[model samples]
Target: MTEPNLPSGNDTDTNSSAIPGTAAAWERATLERLAMATLIEQRQARRWRNGIRIAWLVFVAAVAWFGWERGAAPADVSKPHTAVIEIKGEIAAGGDASAEQVVSSMRSAFEDSGTQAVVLLINSPGGSPVQAGIINDEIHRLKAKYHKPVYAVVEEMCASAAYYIASGADKIFVDKASIVGSIGVLMDGFGFTGLMDKLGVERRLMTAGENKGFLDPFSPQTEKQRAYAQTMLDQIHQQFIGVVKAGRGNRLKETPETFSGLFWTGQQAVEMGLVDQLGNLDYVAREVVKAEELVDYTRRDNVAERLVKRFGASIGEGSVHALKLAPSLR
Candidate 1:
């Protein structure tokens, strides 16, 4: 009687319930995975759409800027006018008033048949002497070849390297109150040896040549190195003096303070023979050149160059930071 007994109803019901629960769990998990995959795909699609829109906007902006720059070329040069070239801001190798820009503009002005004369509109606190020297030499050469009188019209301030280039002009005109002159050469730097000593820091610099690290700020500068630097500066000063003397000739009223690296008012400069007269661009064009119309021929950085420079500024900044560890000229 005991062997013939079957399974209980409760056991059968529990087994059947367990099988449906497991299957339901598996189906729910699969549905969840499918929903998550759809969400991920939607997010990726949205990102791609945003990226494309941004790229299209940038492309359109670049094209429009380029077109505007190209269409902004100067008008015809074959018209009677006074050719004006601006020498404004710092005179450096890659600046707006650099030797290359100024020289190129001068050539264009001088070659034009209708150009009555070339005028330099200078406004600067001065910069690199090497750049100034190149421009000064080019001025003399162009004048000799073209036989066109080149005049310098000063506004606001013109000192140091700016005056260096102006010296080559046939005549320099300045406003009565304009600042002028700074006839000298300089090599400025700083020393941190005492500070480093106080901080208990050591500079372990290695060089093949004995004087290779002479200009290093953290290291102590020897008397011999100082003398060598002074000699170099003196030679450059003499060269600058010679250029001014040759340019001004008998007109310059030489005095002890003339080449002492001092600046003066435009009125005082006129009295000292450093400037010709009190005038302006309009006055020079109308009275001197007898050409009323002024035509500008200044070369400037184009739209594309400016954009490239702006984007590459971070790279340039990193290079400058590295260069700061080494000695350099101003």
Candidate 2:
């Protein structure tokens, strides 16, 4: 009876009980692995979502910045009121320092509503009379159109035609170290008649008019030619004097020699009535315009455009510098 009662502890029933325990352990391990895999998936999903959100935010910010910069929108008048327009370099027909560029800048300055006044920062030796005239006329037009006061500031040097452009301003300012008042016209060339004679060179020029070859290097100048040239220069000089007088009004104290193509220091210019005030641009803006904030309505150049202009300027400066460095026989 005892033998047949039940299997012992090492019997099949006991082993079967151990099998269920092992199966339960395996199931627990499987469930733990599943939980770890789920946790990893969730973490990866959250990280991916955060990364996508950050990328989207960056894209939106870039778009907004570029839009504000490049879009055709209204002027941002968050700061000062007066607009500054620079008239730098030579006033020529085709150059960065050209009448057209100056005139365009003036026009844009007046066009902007935020521009309460204008400051023309002039630093030039001179170039073309016609170009200067165009700039002067545009300045006049803009001043009258906007009913805004225009102040001209001479930086280092404002000579000849450069002064012509500045003369149109309501008030001219100059610093103590600045040079002003080179109020005349010049056309220069060398006559090589003697050199050509020594070199056995013959003159071979065809002209229908007798005066066409008047200042030819190979020909000798006549009394009439000299007289005619003087008359022309005189006429141009008188025109310059008249314009300066008109623009400066009762402020100018002119003698026969004031407009005789003479330059003066800024201090001397103030004493001689060539400049209205002996002050810099900041002084003028602070006193006359009565504002510390200034706006430069100058159209900003893009990266590519700036690079091109600088490249051209560099090439120009390099060539001129190279020529100057070249040795000369004389």
What is the TM-score of each predicted model, taking all chains together?
0.80, 0.68
Can you tell me which runs of candidate 1 are displaced by over 4 Å? 1-64, 67-73, 315-330
lDDT, residue 275, model 2? 88
**Alpha-carbon lDDT of model 1:** 0.90
Candidate 2 per-residue C-alpha lDDT over 1-330 given as tens digits, one digit per residue, 9 for 90 to 100: 456687777888778899899999999999999999999999999999999899668656655554434222246863457778777888887665687767777777787776678898889998898898888888888777789888998999989998998899988999888999889888788899899899999888666678888877788889999999999998888888888988999888878778778899999888888888787878877888886677665444444445456656876997888887565432
Local lDDT at 142 for model 2: 77
Residue pairs with backbone overlap in model 2: 80-293
Give candidate 2's total backbone clashes: 1
Q: After superposition, how far is residue 102 of candidate 2 from its true place, in Å?
A: 0.6
RMSD score of candidate 1 (Å)? 5.5
Per-model root-mean-square deviation over C-alphas: 5.5, 19.8
TM-score of 1: 0.80
